[model samples]
Target: MILIGQYDSPFVRRVAIALRLYGFNFQHRPWSTFGDAELIAAYNPLRRVPTLVLDNGETLIESAMILDYLDELAGPEKALIAARGPQRRQCLKSCALATGLADKAVSLLYERVLRKDHPSQIWVERCEAQIGAVLDALEKERAAIASPFWFGTRIGHADVAVACALRFTGEAHAGVFDDVRHPALADHASRCEAMQVFREFVQPLIPPKG
Candidate 1:
């Protein structure tokens, strides 16, 4: 398998981390959507990161889709997400919120960097507010969970998703997002990052080439 995209992207990073956790061996392209648009377009016309090319010549686009495929590959017992019931719903809900937060952070970054000369203050403010709201909600949810991982002793999709999002938001908007303000989430991210999988797959943030 070939994993295309820079780890700076939370979406890509989460997928990469999950692949490692699942014990999959694949090549890392580390391609940038901006710097390697044509290359990525060859596989994904959307030119999005986190595009996974399987050995059988199948390609997967979008982190969620790739993750779902991975969970299926891992089978019921070892899948990061719960297979069904209320547990699955809660896990999916957390993953949704975390990824949504990441999407907003990425948008804010593009708006600020790509349109620096004429960025919309309204959009920036809205994104900032949404980031804050998501952080608050996630922090509370995490605080209530006394287990080592969000779902239990074993780490799951929600844990990875939230950790990746928090890492990106903290770095991309360091001035606005203070770890001290979201202690529970901060701690959760810290624990995740300390793991070898996260440390090995990590990359520093790089603004898109405009």
Candidate 2:
């Protein structure tokens, strides 16, 4: 398998981390959507990161779809998410919240950096509010979990998603995220970053300068 896109993106980073946890070997392209738009468009018409090129010449776009395929490949017991029941719903909900936070962070960053001349304060404020709301909800959920991982003792999709999103949020927005407000989430991100897989597959966030 070939994984395209830089790890600076939370979406790409989460997929790369999951591949390592699932013991799947793949080549990393580390392409930038800004610089490698044409190259990425060949594999993904939408020109998005986290495009997974399968061994048999099939391509998968979007992190969630790639993750779903990988979960199936890893089998039910070893999958990063619960295969069924309430646990699955909980994991999915957590992932949705984390991803939504990441989406807002990306939007906010673009609004500030890319739209220098006409950046909308309203859009920035809206995105900031959404990011804060998601973080508050996730912090409460993670705080209530007494176990090491979000779902339980074992690491799951929710744990990875939240950690990746938190890292990106801090990197992209600088002082926007308050650690005191989300201590559990801060700790969770730190623990995940300490892992060898995360260390190996990660990239420093490089926000565009004004």
For model 1, the stretches where C-alpha displacement exceeds 4 angstroms are none
* lDDT (0 to 1) per candidate: 0.93, 0.92
Q: Ten residues in a row with the worst lDDT in model 2?
A: 201-210
Q: Per-residue lDDT tens digits of candidate 1, residues 32-66?
A: 99989899999899999989999998999999999
Model 2 collision count: 0
- The estimated TM-scores of all candidates read 0.98, 0.98
In candidate 2 the C-alpha lDDT for residue 196 amounts to: 90
Q: lDDT per residue, candidate 2, 184-205, as tens digits?
A: 9988988988989889878899
